[model samples]
Target: MTSTMKPSYAIGVDVGATKIAAAWVELSTGQLGPVLRIPTRRDAPGEEIVADIISLALAIELPDNPDSALLLGVGVAVPELVDLHGTIRSQWNFPLPHLLDRLEAALSVPARAESDVRVAALAEARFGAGRDCDNFVYFSLGSGMSYTLCLNGKPYSGSHGFAIHFASSELAVPAQDRSALVAAIPEDYASGLGMVRLWQERGGFPLAQGIHTLEALAAQGNACAQNVIADAAGMGGRLIAQIVNMLDPEKIILGGGLGCSTGTYRTGLETEIRAHIWEQSCTNIPLVMAGLDENAGVIGAALAAAPPG
Candidate 1:
């Protein structure tokens, strides 16, 4: 690690349901290279996806040597449960294992991977909303949902790296023949994707328009879509309130595809949380937007290799 030597350059990637993004960074300078993006091959399977990822990596021409970059290692933020050495078990949407195998075989460098949501949480802890405090939680709501807890400056990966999967507003089913009770919960009222689906099914709007962007609908003030958004926010509030009750995180940051758009939903969500949290005022929890924004996943995944202390 000589000062005169050029800083080590590492590649950073974020693979999600929406996109597969990659970057080259100078670890020593905290300087990130130009970021690149490509639509995720939705439900893309196996080797083709890997080849697609490698192809994207090659698509970029960094300021420095690309061939030498891998020696510094590549860090990937993937959507599924990844093992300590970067083996993915299963992902709800699109998934894969041994991403490192492809990179190593193609280029010959150590690679690492972790859940995209958890990586985003890591980014928040290191340089974003959770900057000052440890033992905080980063929650995200979108097509899929999850939350990550950073305790004592380290991201909480859970026993099996699946902590966030349970926080979903839709999946928290009651035990036994308690269908009636589960139905009463707000989660059944909305999940991000469910809301969009409901607009077409129950709400009656020309929603099936080939429009892919959430922004496209948000701009029109489409009342039906608005209702769906509010409903989804309310559902999130319940899950958030419960996390506050159990962990007492110092800061609660929102993130993910929906996190950025949540300014559109928070007022409703805050109102719902205030009404439901049992000891609300006594427990002061701050719900702030993620400062790191969309890049949290890639940045956090990199930190997984050197997560916040």
Candidate 2:
């Protein structure tokens, strides 16, 4: 559908490494309906992944008139890299590059897709943490690390939509390991998978359990888990501070699974942010939690399809 068509409602779906979440969005008001979540078939082929998204979209009850223009399209927020045309660019996780075409054909509605982090930032800009801020950074520490720079409530995808590839940026931060200084990219230690990998490398927890198990261990007074989490948070904070230093955004909004989780990680990140900020005046910039919770991605994805005027 053309932008002039102005669909009143859209389906927003967030595709993650672990789960797929979706919701119905009212385009005019930026309000989201109840969310539907299901585990992702992480190892499945692109076809299966697309099928899952189709299933989720179809699960939401359509209007009495299925052919009505009111429910106009599907908006997807995916973990993989997406191009300006809504084609998946990276095969790192799934090979469904023609996702938009397949989705549109299957659902008989227009569809749009973008980087999950970017869409989440869009959601926050329109309806969540960044709603009142004109300039801010939306950094997510999920299964992967990436960020979207929002200016005037619109996310800047850069000249080629490759701007926010923070995980592979080669920007290293220093940390102490066994009395020796070591450094690695933020993706190696700060992301959700990175934290789990760090735990496995340290040989403290069972291989099957991931970050949540580590959080549990930390809460139970396990020193190793606590240390690993603290170290990871430090790495994340240092990296985020670099963004703040460069952009000087009005605020930094944190989101994603690891980002929004309740634990010492948040406190640890805040502490490190205060410690590493180069400019004292910028140190007080509010490091606020994402206001939309898990629904941010879906709501934002929907908004992507049916942008608010």
Candidate 3:
């Protein structure tokens, strides 16, 4: 019997600070199979991590028939600074140059790397919430915060390929002592870490609860949790509103564990965004949660490695 599977599939790897996830993407249908995740050996040498990534990609099951299935290439998404050629310049203090070279030699297939947020934006543009829009801004608010501006369905990586590093942009917030000035970045007030910091600052009960648990607690009417989340959401909204005002994107897609949740946080975020939007016409700009969720990064890597026909 003739196999119905496509002739080739792309492997996508998402390398995060805590874990590395990989999957095989069917080129013809854009379907992603089960993801294989391994705890990231962040402390290990960069070369070792690269080897792990390559091995994981090679181990993924392709189509049953050898003649019917081929490994197209590999795409990697890393939480680091990457150049246009997929070279990791620097991030997390790991030696990435050697790793990049080793990956290419070991894989024997075209390998492309990109910033994780950029890859996620690519995935959303092709298959998720941004599929119908040519221009949109993708915000990833997790342990870190980043945003990618997509124009004409392509991510705008500035001259240095660091256009999305909004976390470093300074923002003025009240000092902890309330007697002096404090300057903080968006990530300090808008990401998972920021939420936890806010909770701690506000002296929330059960201080051990993580961001997810805090969300649950907030849902249960915990005032401290609510305040922490609300503050973060509001700040996040202001940052997003700034992006909207500058780019005028048709939509703003929010991703990451905390950003995608539906409820008070999102409501508060949207409320602040609406309040800050300057243009009357921009008031209707859609602010939607990411549809692809966790798979977005890997799928995006695959899409970047092998552009759709």
What lDDT does the true structure give each of the candidates?
Answer: 0.68, 0.83, 0.82
| Cα lDDT tens digits for candidate 3, 89-139 | 776535555665566687777888889999999888878889898899999
**Per-prediction TM-score:** 0.83, 0.90, 0.88
Q: How far is candidate 3 from the true structure (C-alpha RMSD, Å)?
A: 3.2
The deviation in Å at residue 85 for candidate 2 is 2.2
RMSD in order of candidates: 3.9, 3.9, 3.2
Question: Please, what are the lDDT tens digits per residue for candidate 2 over residues 1-309?
Answer: 655654488999999888999878887777777788999887888788888888888898644454554886899998877888777788766666467887888778899988898998988998899989899999878788889999998999988786677665565334645565554576878888888888878886574668878888889998888988998888888878888888899999989887898887888988887788899999999888889977888988988886655
TM match of model 2 to true structure: 0.90
Please give the TM-score that candidate 3 achieves against the real structure.
0.88
CA error at residue 62 for candidate 2, angstroms = 3.5
Task: For candidate 3, give the lDDT of residue 163.
Answer: 78
How good is model 1 by TM-score?
0.83
| Candidates ranked, most accurate by lDDT first | 2, 3, 1
Q: Model 3, poorest ten-residue lDDT window? A: 92-101
Top candidate by lDDT: 2
